[model samples]
Target: MIMTKPRIAIAGASGFIGIYAIEELSKNFRIRALCRNLPTTNSLNSDVQWFSCDLFNLKEAEIAFQDCDYILYLIHSMTKGSRLTQSTFDDLDLIIADNVRRSALKNNIKHIIYLGGIIPEINYGISRHLKSRNEVEIVLTCSGIPLTCIRAGIIIGSGGSSFQIVYRLVKTLKIMTTPKWTKSLSQPVDVNDVIQFIKLCVGNKEVYNKVIDIHGTELISYNELIIKIATLMKLKRTLITLPFFNLGLSKLWLYIITGIDYYTISPLIDSLKYDLKANHSLYFNNYIPNPISLNDSLQRAIENEEKNEIKPRRKTFEENKVRTVQRLNLPMGWDSIRLGKEYINWLPKVFFTIIRSKVNNNIVRFTFLKINLLTFEFSDDRSSTDRQLFYIKGGLLVIKKDYPPARFEFRISPHEQSAIAAIHDYYPSLPWPIYRIFQASFHKMVMYLFNKHLIKIQNKKV
Candidate 1:
């Protein structure tokens, strides 16, 4: 009798760590690579099966994780999924994490492994980026299934975003004007070492349900790291530090030099202000005594780039689809069911003359000037006290509806004192440009007002 290897399902399998992970983990585990789009390039292992999954959709996540014994969650929601995204990265990350948790629970998966950022010891004034990462970690931890969260610092490798930022800065500028944030320290880990750590943690009973922080042997300042990179590159550069320089100027400077977008760079720059060395140091020290050096990692990354072997992760967006997420103050003792009802009642009251909302036979209608603008049917089967789901059945603003239709979700945040209201997979009747300007803007304004209303309700109760 032959024993089959444990099937490992990898989300974000086309990314930097995912690609490397597939190449490495395929040797030991039966690999099931889950991604939004199937990669155009060949996989290192021909036996690795690919499953196309849009992780934002819970049904898709459940289907993708089926038959897999362990899950390697490598997803990050920094890039846009639709043509226009009216949501913050944190909200998107939370939703995706919740979906993964639910999917894993329903499937009865054995273990989940999440790779996240190194959270600062002093939690005060944490950047949105790190906070988002921490929130994701929290969501996964509550899954009841065993979880191992490896919080790593700036990952050093070719094609990796963090490394590229450094590489580009060193290569591009001869005379660089730096901010005080450059003095902040970080323990940078090599991509290969990160992969090794993941390999060690897989099927290891000791590491399950633990948060491990791993990093390189040395903790160096950003300025020192940059100087080292410059030395390795054999380039002569002058650096002038501005102690009072603001973050806005730093963002613009890096954006101009690296040519990376503000969305990607903003969080990274914000995170650089705090020193983020690992706290749980000896967890994996016994297994891999000698980690890769920063100089060597930089050298290898440079070589890979010179050889044209590295490819950055690519994002593919759908046309005309919309996803909007807003975090609102949750009225104390209120669940999603009541929150959804409150939203319905509040909408008409807020815009009394122009808008009218009513529910008949569990079907909700929002009308403008007595014309049905939107229709939603309550989904009792898909809803719970913690989460309420409403399907967008038909509306004047809807041009075409996909199978299962789009949805509106009012969900209670597990840990935070807030509720999340989101619209998913919505396609408008208006032209893309027109919808983006008018309908999108209007929806955001309404949500903003609703948030104010919630705060007022809480204040009155207090």
Candidate 2:
């Protein structure tokens, strides 16, 4: 009798490690790509089957994991903007692990492999990202499925999120003054080596039910990593470390300078204060006799990035236009506030009047309010022509047409009705009382309605 190839499902298959894992495993195992978004069939091998399901949803996860022998859980929320804090990491990790484990149990998956971070001892206060990874591993271990957790240091590959941060910073800055943490130790691994270890774990029962640490041989400081990258790119760089700099502040500065965003860089910078060195004896004993070196790994990543051979095909606005529109069109309730005697009146009719949908998901809502005589501005000696016209959705409100063009633009969350208000009221001169009162009451009400309505929509979908 001939043995058949084992079927495998890879959640987060669209990510850095997951994509490479699929490529590496496709030749051997029957591969199933499980992700929130449908995998673009354009680049994937025809043998792989693509399934779309949100990992957090139990029913959706069940359908995605059905009939698979092995699962690769590589999902994380680093791409979710500013909200990717420690709490978000914990919530998302718990939810995803619970759903995936339950589904794995039902489908009788033989093994689960997770890719996680390797932190330094000094910085062991669970960062949102690290805590989340640790929590998921805990959930997986107790799930009854044999599990292999590969905790790795900073992945040094082009196109990977961590690498992109270091890459862009080194490329953009000529002289860098950074926090003291820049001198912290890290063992950066090549993406390909990480992928190779993941692939090797497929049928290796000895490695099952184990947490393995993987890293390149060299342990270098982050500043050294930057210098190496600068040397590779042939860019001149000078570095100075300030004693009192905060990671949070540094993250904001990096985001502004490099365009990588604060949420993505914060956890990385925070974790950098510790030594991330790992014991490689176990890896050598179980896996390849000689793993790829740091230089070889870096070279390969640079070459691949140059060749544009990475997965997920960085989406252009034209490609995402439809999805963007769909998200905008998703129904969200509206609230209108009309200027009043003592305070503004919060009512639906006032908020939704004269709403205009502009190009590229921009929306504007206009409302005209009658000036109340008892209002402070009306009590002033000025003539009674006082009327307030509020322009919202992009956070533009014109109390006076003669006011200069909007200095800042804002967008309302698709499922939330509240437009950020104080930006307009503070310009020219600050109106502290007016701004404070309107913002607190109106903003709170809008968020309340928006969340209430969003919950209803999600429940209805179920």
Candidate 3:
């Protein structure tokens, strides 16, 4: 009998850990990347396939993970912008995880491997963050698939959230006043070791339905880890711990100094109230024998960051709202044709729209040929661009790239004689749950059309 490499679907392939997981796992498994957006072809393995998907939607998830036997569950909303509060994030994580569970079962997926937090042994000191992580595990296993949970503490590696937090704190501070929580014990694991352990679990019956503990070579407090990292970087740093600095103060310090979002870091700080040393973890030695040491992992983490090997794991809400403005000058003004009346009229004659219908308004609309009508509404934005209006999209902060052109009716001197054209984009901010996966080339197409229109107006050759 010819044996086939089990097809594995990665639900969050665009994330930092997810991308690295794909790169390492591709050699052994047939890879399928399911993400909110399509990645560039060159970034994927030749045999790898991509499915644009939104996990919150079960229909999309079913299609994305179809025909795959195993799932590498790397989705987490701790840093996701849509997750406003820790409570909100916990609810959202449960919803998304449950959706994945249902979809995985629908697709007949057999096993799921999850990377989650290591909970504190004491039930009384359990945090909302830890509870959320536990809930995800519960939801994943409720679907009846064997869920392999790899509980990790602070992960020390380049591009990792936990590592980045420590790096920023150490790199930015010379003399620091840290909070009381810094003294808590933490066992951090290397990114490479984490990846290797995940690789070892594939097709392993021993790891099924198991909760494994994976950490660094030794346990240390955050204070010691900071000092070690500082020594490695050859920096002189002084640390004074104060119990009075509460979570609010710590959150503010991280926000103001490190420039990381305080909302995301706040809950994590809350969870750090207790020690995060792993206990009773099913020994990973069942598969892989060697684990990377903290010194080597810390050194490699810095080297990777310095070498620019780190890529962004997740996007803040602001990244989704891409805005672009292109300006054009009509050296010779329109004589007979006023504004784009002629151009607008000319579009229907040549432009290929999927539908032959449109709504009549102040803003002219051109719909693209797609499953959904991608309509570009061109209206005047009250500027030298022969436009006088900009409408705000649903809760999106509309940014006009250039300040509404500084116009002075009271002439200090003769203004330059030219018709200025400007473009504006208001991308609506949709909640992550219902977001539909679509091609990203729409932005580039807008620019291409804008430049082409300028050339045409200049009476230049094609």
Candidate 4:
């Protein structure tokens, strides 16, 4: 008799850790990699199954998790997912986590293993990035499934954004201007060790429904880390500590030297103000007795880069695409479906009656002076109490051929007190400058007014 391995689905399988994970975990289980785009080559692992899915859509997430026994959720949206994103990373992370939670419950998965950040021992304040990670943890836990969340700090690996910032800073600057946040302590774990920790947690009954922390053997300050890296590279670097260097100046200095985007660097800098170390000491120590050292991990990262181990990332979005997400207060008696209907009904009262809206059967149209400006067809099959989706069917404001029509959606948040009105993959028919100047501004103004309307309703109920 032959034995079959348990099937596991990996979200964010195209990322730095995800790519390595697919190679290592495929030897033990049947791997199904969920990504936004399929890999051009099957060289990573031919046996690994790849499913292209946009996790924002619940139906897509459900289909991606089909027939999977365990889930490895490694998704993060530090970089914008669309060409134009009007939402914060925190909200973006929350929505994606909710989708993952819903999909996991629908599929009846056995376990979910999530990779998150090591929150500071002092839980009073944290960076938005870390807060977002914590929010994702909550959403996944609320699914009533067994979850093992592994928290780590400053992953040292090839192609990792955090490590690359450190590496670039040391290489580029001969004299570094240090801020007070550099004095904060951190335990930088190696990516290989993270992968090993994940491997041990899968199907492990003892670690189920627990939060575990993993870190490198050495605990060093960020200043010490910089000096150590300089020694390793055989470079003589002078560091000048500036007591009064504010967050703004620090961000600018790092951005200028490391060339990392503000979106990726901002929250990371915010996190450096707090000491980040592993609290659980012996939980998984038996499995990984000598979790890799800082010196050796740095050496490995350098070697991997020298050998060109990093692969090129495939482009995920087309040019001229736009995504706008607006969060509004949900009335006490309102669900997402109700909020969506109210929006359509309120359109006629907008812009001093210049805009008109009409709904016929499943189709909806918005017009100016009886000339159609936009059209949407309600998706009956996709509508639910928590979410309502409308397909951008046609109108003067849309292109003639949209392969899969762009979507306009209203979705309730995890806590149910708020809702989001979002437009995804929308490409305007107007010219870029014209759309940016007039159409975009008009859309935002309309949403702002709608938010005000909701607030008034809530006040009345009070």
Candidate 5:
């Protein structure tokens, strides 16, 4: 008999951890995402159902989880309490958990998975931050349903709070005066490992009704972590430990030097006051054996930042004009002269041109196999190949009659040594998901055609 995929509901789906968890878990299970605001993402999977919801509204929460078999909760408020009123973070956590349990009970949900902080080594010395996490776990357990609480220490991954703090401290100062918190031992786990655990524990019986403690193999102090990070980045640094430094003073100094909001840093530092290692290592039946090392995890974080640094942010506009551009070097730079400008331009050798304010209505026809298979034209086609450089601007980019509707911009710029092109397509008319499949190839083809035209022009061929 063929088995049906389970339905998993992800609460707080807009968080960084929730976002990644959805990507990982969606492969084998149907996913339902619940959040107050729609996530700002263009690469969302087609199979997932995203619902905008306010969890505090019991009716709304129950409706959202009506069909889900598993619930994965990954949300924690940093500011804590009621917005205008001063309520504690722990209190707010319990309130949210009660709402989730009520909804789960109404929907007959089977499992609840939560990612929480590991308990502090000292019995009663738990920081306010960790206490909130522990209290949340207790709230979930009160529902009388099977719960899997994967407790972990500072997660070392891209965009994680702990990693971001380390990044700011290392990037800002070469020489620093730190407090005793820097000496506390910590067992940082990789974000990838967290994802691995979530994926494995979906319907596994061994992890049910258990509070599992997870962490990496290495046990290092904050001072050591900073030193290793600096060395990996190839920087010189000096650290001075000052025992007299006050917690309030440390938070103020961090806010001033790093420009990180004090609200987020306060509770984090409080948690760092004690040793933050797991009570004991976890061994699940379906666990991903042998997580990656600390060095590898740090390297991954750096790589993620480097990629985000160069990605382009799309702009909002009245007309839905979407575009992707790239720069590349062709093997031959002198081909523009032979087939660069004017006179048929051979295969086609035109460089960049300034786009006119408005588009022109002109029709150009191309015949194929004794029949007019394709007929199209650009609004403006003033060709140029001066000094092995030219561009195509304000042209009719008709791909078959009725296409592009009307009003589109096409620009091409070619220099003595390089070329650039920006192709814009109407959002509603273009096949976005289909186009994404060939985005890389499209970039390569643009470059290929630019260079090939020069060869055809020099050979005196059409």
Candidate 6:
């Protein structure tokens, strides 16, 4: 009994989950990747084909899904803007769903598999990210296509946005001032299991027109998840929940601390107010025989992250020539000499002047001051760096050359107060003034001589 591989088309094939899904399904399926960017790796099996097509464009989407048996819709627009509003999220969902439905109908695609959020309720406290997921599910269900929607909670994986945030926060913080939503329950699933579920849904007649809730074996609170992560990393953490902490304010705080965009964090924090625990009774009765444990999933995720760290990161032409001077000890009052022209008097004064520069061209033209701290030393070859350390801890970006890295320990200072005023004057839209000030302080200026320079520093050895 010889079985032939099904021809499957994956939209948003370049995304985190999409890439993982491709890796899992590529061996058993003839894949057609529909993405905005062309596939970078030539290592894809010969059975895979790529089409550079924007999913928002209905015409292009139609062409992309042509002759495909199954269509996987795994796209979202959280990173496109500063705020993920409910209206904006809904609009994107409607647009994607309509376009996908039309394309599927035109191409006679047999089935459509959509990955969406598990949260049923939506509110101001709920993140725009989760609301968007809910909207996408509605659109797919209403569409004429036989849609299989897999509603999943936080997916715990190495490179996933949610997991990355938790991993970094847990690894870095010792005393955590978390919000009330830390007690909210969520059932996170493994990335591997998510891919498996998607693969199983492909052309499965029994599950073709069903909405399944998928999750890991454990139902734990955000605080518990943090504790588990800290335990895994062998770090001691003391958790303190602030009763009056504003959710939106907390998101802004997290953005400053984690270097994760506020737009993404806003929605994630909103979703934490509700219980995202998945009811796996249906899944157990219908889908697989068993699901993986949270411990095992976390272990795999860490391994994957370690592997990713060692993997060679590909950079653009502009990124390659950009030199990163590690822990360069710049003396106080260090002046910039650019092509024999003196740009500024000293490092601190120059930084202050750079912040005051109101001109847009002036902002992006010269080299910006960039500061980062080496936080976790995994090995002699590998170490973790946090770019937003100063900002997160309410420390101002001080102007000093030859400042030792050890002097920049996470703390709050009076200079942080002055930094806020400077940041607000320059970048008004930045939510937390104090945080932005810290970010701007440890700045790196790339001289115009290397305008198109791109540099990648590899700390991990394969």
Model 4 lDDT tens row, 169-269: 88879998899988889999889888988988898998989998888988899899999888887888888888999878888888777777767788788
User: Candidate 3 regions off by >4 Å?
Assistant: 1-3, 80-87, 309-462
Tens digit per residue, CA lDDT, model 3, 232-343: 9898889999999897788788777766566568778888778988885655755546678889999988878768844433434643333222223433554212444544
The C-alpha stretches of model 2 lying farther than 4 A from their native spots are 81-87, 122-124, 309-462
Per-residue CA lDDT of model 6 for 1-462, tens digit only, reads 978788899888877798888888887898888787785666447877878886645557888888789989887765432211112444444555656876788788888899888865434556667766866766566556788888888998877878877876786688999989888888888888889888888888777677788888889999999999888777899999998887877888787667666656776777778888676438533565567889888878877776776232222222111111111211222222221112222223445644321113212112234322211111211111211111111112223222222111111111111000001001212334443344333332322112112111111211
Q: What local lDDT does model 6 show for residue 299?
A: 79
| Winner by lDDT | 1
The regions of model 4 sitting more than 4 angstroms off are: 309-317
| TM-score winner, 4 or 6 | 4
Local accuracy by lDDT, each model: 0.88, 0.61, 0.66, 0.86, 0.64, 0.59
RMSD of 4: 2.2
Quote model 2's TM-score. Answer: 0.65
- Please estimate how well model 1 matches the true structure, expressed as its whole-model Cα lDDT: 0.88
Ten residues in a row with the worst lDDT in model 6? 416-425
Clashes of each: 0, 3, 9, 0, 14, 22
By lDDT, the better pick of 5 and 6 is 5
For 1-462, candidate 1 gives per-residue lDDT tens digits of 988889999989988899899988998999999988897875656659988888888778889999989999988887788878899999999999999999999999999999999999998999999999989989988888899999998998888888888888888899888899999999999999999989888878899888888898789998888899999989988889999788888988887788766678888888899999899867768667899998899899988875884443344568888999999999898899889999999998889658999799779999999899999989898899999998998878987654364889898887778989999888899998899889999999999999999999999889
| lDDT of model 1, residue 195 | 92
Q: At residue 450, what lDDT does model 2 achieve?
A: 46
Q: Would you list the clashing residue pairs of candidate 2?
A: 86-128, 336-350, 336-351
How accurate locally is residue 416 in candidate 6, as Cα lDDT from 0 to 100? 14
Candidate 3 deviation (Cα RMSD): 18.1
For model 2, where is the 10-residue window of minimal lDDT?
A: 320-329
